[model samples]
Structure formats: C-alpha cells, structure tokens
Target: MKAPALEQRKLLDLQAADNRIAQLQHTLRTLPQEVRLAELQRDSVAARQEFGGVNGELEDARAEIARVEADIDTVAAREKRDRERLQASSSSKDIQGLEHELASLKVRRSNLEDIELAVMERVEEIEQRLAAITARRDDIATEERLLAAQRDEQRDRVAAQLEVAKSERSAIAGGIGAELLALYERQRERYGVGAALLQGGVSLGTNVALTESDLAQIRAAAPDEVVLDPDGACILVRTEESGL
Candidate 1:
C-alpha cells in the first residue's frame, strides 16, 4: 500500500512535468513574433512589386517623350530644307513640289507636338506614382526591421522558459523512489495520465470514473497491497511485480 501510494505521488509529478512540457511546446509552436514576421515579409514583397511596376512605367514614358522630341526635330529640319528649295527654285512645277513637301512637314510637326504633350502628361503621372510607391516601400522596410527584432526577443524568452521546465523536471524525477518511478513510467507509456488522486470517492484525473465493484475489489485487497487503477478497473500489484 505504501509503494502504491508512493507510485501515485510519483505519477502526479510526472503529470505535472508533461503539462509543463506541453505548455512550453505550445509557446514555441505559436510565437506571435513568427506570425508578425511572415506578414511583414508579405507586405514588403508587395510594396517592392508596386515600386518596380511604377518605375517601369516611368521609364517607358520618358522613352516615348524622347522619341517624340526626335521626330519633331527631324520634321523641323525637313521644313527648313524645303523652304530653302522654294526660295531657290524658278520653275512653277518645282515650287509646287516644295510647297507640298512643306505642307507635309508642317502636319507631321503638329502631330509630333501633340504626341509630346501626351507623353509629358504620362511622365508626370508615372513620377507621382513612383514617389508614392517608394515612400510606402521605405515604411514597410522599417516595420520589418522592428518585427525582426521582436521575433528575436520572443525566441530568447521561449528558450529561457524551456530551460527552466527541463531543470524542474529533472529535480522532480530525482526525488521519486526508483521502484515507484519505474511503475509510474510504465503506466505513463500506456496511459497519458499515469496516476490520479482518488478524490470525492472518485478518480480525479481519468476520463471516466471507477465503478463501485472495482472500488470494493480494491478495498478487499490486503492492507499492504499495491493497487493501480487501469482504464477505470482496479488491479492489485503483485509483490514480485517489478514493472506494471
């Protein structure tokens, strides 16, 4: 009976250890810093993508403006050449050809000017968008840095807690008797709850309660009998039984 009582206490200690270990494991698995860091990374990626797209649009607009300006310059040069041809030509047919060429050049210049104005407007819009994107990217980068620091701090705290739990478990295991410890370990392997307090005439830790007949059987055993409740059924521990 003394051995069984001792075994029961040892089982209680084991249960405490298991609960503490589970708590530490849960903290490690669901750290808030980890979730925050993942969100920060996702936001940073989106910001960078937006910034890149804006910059691409800006570059395209500038390229178009340059092309339009070059076309305008070509038309102006053609107009100057045609005007000189008109002043030097004496034949009516040659003058008419020069006039026609000048008319075509003027139309092309007007078209090129309109295109240039549209390209300038597009450039302004792209620059505004790029600036906004850059500012947002910078803000996200700052937030990410802060979140990374927080994550590191959280990891350190969890590590410290795990160490404390491990030391406490070792101390508890060392205080228990060897025979009692062995029995508790065996039961723990088979059942999650190794031992429970018989409280209110009932097992306090088991999912189900022991029946009246089972309690009567336990009471009928010898005064020194070592008994265990297995799956809500009572079992008398044989004196020679080293492990159960």
Candidate 2:
C-alpha cells in the first residue's frame, strides 16, 4: 500500500472521530435517568395498591357509620310513639309497659351513637393515610418529570456531538485518495489499526522498537513510501520526528 506521508497523518484524526462516535453511542444507551425511571414505575405501582386499599376501607367505614345513624333514628322514633301512648292512656298496666319499652329504646340509641362515633374516628384515620399516599405519588411524579427532562437534554447534546464527529470524519476521508482510503479502512477493519506513527525506530501501533535489519529496510525506502512495521499491524507514517 502507498500513500503520501501527509495523507497518512490524517488517519489519526479520522480514528479519533470514530472513537468519539463510539463513546457518544455508549452514553445514549446507559443514561442514569433511564434506570431511575424504571425504578419509579415500580414505585408507582406499589403506591397505587396502597392507596386503593386505604380508600376501600374508608368507604366501608362510611357505610358502617350511615347504618348506625339509621338505627339510632329508628329507636328515637319508637320512643316518641311510646311516650305519646303513655300520656293518652289511663290504664296503669299500659303505662308501665310503655315506660319499660322507652327505657330499652334509649339504651339501643346510645349504643348506636357510640358505634357511629367509633366508625367516624376510623374514617378520619383512613383519610389521613390516603392523603399521605397521594402526596408521595405527587412527589414521585415530579421527580420523574425532572429526570426525564435531564435525560432528554443530555441525549440531545450527545447526539449533536456524534453528528459533528461523523461530519469531520467524512471531510477527512474525502481528501484522501481512493486507494489509500481503501487500504486504511481494510487495515482498520481487520486489526483495529489503520495507521501508526514511526518515531525513533518504534511503531506506536504495537509500541515496539524495530530490530537492526528492519530499520535498515525502512531506511532504504523512499521518503514518500508507506511501510508497515515488522508486526504488520498498521501503516507506519514517518516524518522528521521519526528520527530516521
């Protein structure tokens, strides 16, 4: 393979751009906000379940309270009717029976009121729990929105960087001759080494120095010539810094 020394140097820039693209792609795939969003989904489900349970219990408590109040009203009405009958009747036996029935109704009404009070207290507790659960859900939603906004912003920045890198690589590739470009691409695809700097008799690709015979061979080649290191990993580009 033969390429001008100047053309060979541009391979470093192309390689760097390719590395930038790879890095940006990796960032897009592993954003931290994505992981947090997944966890929030699970948290949302658990919160919903707890809220449903508490709400159902509150409803049951309300129904129980209504039933108790109804029972109290019925007992009060029965006592009023008994009192009316006792005042109108002159018979002693009827008056005595009415008094006993009225006494029983008062006891039943008192028990129903107690039951209603207890159930109202329970309903208040359940309502407090539901309010707490609702507040937690709101917090989670707010966090999710914030994280999502951050994720989108980061993704846009990374995507823009990737586009710029690809454009730079394209511009560099356009300047190189077809034969040289093909050779560089082939070496890169085959061994992940497209070009290496030949400095002080060393190939940067493998970070190894050449032997006496190998140095002699490269020294004999033309200044415009392109050569590979003994390891044959990459095209070695030389300059005054090569210390030839």
Candidate 3:
C-alpha cells in the first residue's frame, strides 16, 4: 500500500510508542516489589505458623502445671488425714505402723513438690517463648502490610504509565493508513515486532536477526518507505547503506 510520506513517518513514532508500551508492561510484570511482596507473604505465613505452634505449646504447658498442682493438693490432703489417724491410734504396733506411713507420706510430698517445681519452670519457659513468637509475628505482619502498600502504589504508577503509553501508541497508529496499520499489527502478532528501521541495511525488530533475503529486500527499498510481506516481515527504509 502507498501511504503518504507524512503517514510513513508516523509509522516510526508508532513503532517507538509500541516499544515503550511493551517495556512498561515488562517492568510491571517483573517489578522488584512483586517479588518482594511474594517473599514477604511467604514469611508472614510462616511466622503465623510459628506463632500458632508456640501458643499451643504455651497452653499445653499451662494445663500441665494446673494438673500437677491439683495432684499436689490431693496428696497433701491425704497426708493430713493420715496424720490425724495416727494421733488417734493407741497400740504400740499400730503406732509403729502409723510412724512408717507418715515417713512415706513425707517422701511422697517431696516428690510432688519436685514435680511442681519442674512444671513451674516449664511454664515460665513457655511464656517466654510465646511472647517472643508473638512479637516476631507482629513484626512480620507489619512488614507485610507495608510491602503490600508499596506494591499497590507501584502497580498504580505502572498502570498510569501504561495507559499513557497506550494512548500515545494509538494516536501514532491513527496517523498511519489502515492497511499499513493492519499489516503492522499482523506482523507484530507473528514476530513480536511490527516494523523495524532499515538501519545500515539491517532489519532490526525486537532483536530479530534478519536473514540474507530480509536484508536484501530492506536494502532495495527506497528511503523513508514502509515495506511489508506475508512472512510477517515489516521494514521501514531509513538509509541506502547495505550492511546494517
């Protein structure tokens, strides 16, 4: 198709705007904030798991301490009953038996006290662990929130830039003839680059390494003209040099 010279120049601007839009899209997809937010979310989940485990352990420890204390109270009550029974005994053999039972009760009470001490120590340790885990979880939650906000802002900015780039690309494309624009769009879908400048006789399109025939065709085209073919090749002439 024979587009006017002015329309042909607009093709270059269209190509540039399209490239800019593509770059913006790439930046949006691969933003550092995207990766960071993913990692932060993972960490937050892990922190929550840790906090849950710690809380469960603390609860278990507390329950265990309560159980041990109850057992101690029961044992002390039995010892008191045994002492009262000893005081009421009158026979020598009975007195002897009562003294032996009282000695055993003392040993049992010592053992219960030891167990209670150990349980208390465990409770203290669990409390400390729960506190630490809760603090860390809170910190991670805060960081996740901050990162999410920053990521949202970054996404908004990228979206705005994308809209602007799209508008610019559309305006430039509007300046070209419909046939040329259609050809360019088709080539872009096939090759990822709609048109490339014939610089130094080289047809460069989104890192498209040109074949010999492609190079020859570009070299043969008149300056400042757009060329298209069915093989998804689109070239814009810029110079007579045959080696670009």
Candidate 4:
C-alpha cells in the first residue's frame, strides 16, 4: 500500500492514542479505590452479621426482663392478699400462717426483682455494644461513600481524557487513505503496534536492530511505499534519522 510518508507518520499518533485508550479502560476496570470499596462492602456484610447476633442477644435480654417483671408483680400481689387475710382473721394460728406465707412472698418478690435487675443490666450492656457497632458501621458506610465518589471522579477524568484521545485518533485516521488505514488497523490488531520508526536501522516496534540485509531491502522501497519490518510486526517508517 502507498501512503505519503507524512501520512504514515500519523500512525504513531493513532498508536499512541490507542495505547492511552487501552490504559484508561484498564484503569476503569482495576481502580485502586474500587478495590478498597469492595473490601469495605465485604466488611459491611460482616459487620451487619455481628450486629444481628448482638441484637438477638438484646432481644433475649429484654424478654427475660419482661418475664422477671411479671413474676415480681405476681409475688407482690400474693403478699398483698396474705396481709389482708391476716388483718381479717382473729385466730392466732391463722395469723401466724398468714404472716409466714407473707414472709415467703416477700422473699420471692426480692428474688424476682434481683433477676429483673440483672436482665436489665444485660440489656444495657447489649445496647451499648450495639451502639458501638452501629457507630462503626456508620463509619464504614461513610468511607465507602467517599471512596465511591473518589473513584467516580477519577473515572470521569479518565473518561474525558479518553474521549479527547479518541477524537484525536479519529481526526488523524480520517486524513489517511482507506487502504493504508485498513492495513495499519490490521497490523495493530495482530501485533499491537501499527507503525514504528525505523530509527538508525532499528525497528522501534520491537526495539531490535534490523540486520544489514533488512536495511538494504527497506532502502530499496519507494519513499511512499508502505513496508513491513522483517518480523512483520508493523510498518517501518524511515526518516533521515533512520540512517538508511
């Protein structure tokens, strides 16, 4: 394929733009902030599980407190009934039995109150623990949001740069002949570089010095003639610096 030497040089710009596009795409896929965000998301899941277990304990503690309180109420009511019977009964034996029964009720009420107090304390402890966990969860969420925002901002910046690069590539590519552009695209698709400078008898695509025979052959080609390097990796565009 024949393209003016100057037009061939534009392939380098296209190649550079293509490289930047690939790099930006890679950055989008493997952002450092995204990695951290993923970790934070996992941490959030674990934190929620921990909080759920602690909350279950809290619910159990509260239920126990309710049960204890009910028992204390029942005991107190029994004591009141026993006292009323004592005041009404004149028989000494009856009074003694009623007073003894009342004493037992008092002890029962005391025990129930103690149990209620302990359960209440347990609830308080669980609540405190839950609060701390909740605070930590909030902190994690805050950080996740911040990281997400940072990641988005970075993506936007890179996206803008990528658009610019694409526009630049499109403008350069439009000026090239269809046959040459097709050949360059094909080479790039196969070997990653569409064009490279043959500087000082070297193929910059591979950064390898071409043999004397290879340079001799390239020098024989017309200036507007597109030629591939010996390795066929890319079109080797020569200039005065190529030392041909």
Runs off by more than 4 Å, candidate 4 = none
The positional error of residue 62 in candidate 4, measured at the CA in angstroms, is 0.8
lDDT of 2 by residue, 7-121 (tens): 8778767767767777888999998899999999899889999999999999999999888888888898898899999999999999999999988988888888888899999
Candidate number of the best lDDT: 4
Better of 1 and 3 by TM-score: 3
- State which candidate, 1 or 3, has the greater lDDT: 3
Worst lDDT run of 10 residues, candidate 4, spans 9-18
Clashes of each: 1, 0, 2, 0
Model 1 spans with C-alpha error above 4 angstroms: 1-7, 83-96, 218-227, 232-244
How high is the CA lDDT of each candidate model? 0.73, 0.86, 0.74, 0.89
RMSD of each candidate relative to the true structure = 5.4, 3.3, 3.3, 1.5
lDDT of 4: 0.89
Q: TM-score: which candidate is best? A: 4
Model 1 TM-score (2 dp): 0.76
Write out the backbone clash pairs for model 2. Answer: none
Prediction 4 TM-score vs. true: 0.94
- Taking the tens digit of each residue's C-alpha lDDT, what string does model 1 give over 1-244? 3554454455566668867877888888888878877887888899888888889888888998998999899999889988998999999999999998899889889999999999899899889888888888888788878877887788788879888888888788887677766666676667655566554445655634557786677666664455677463322333222211
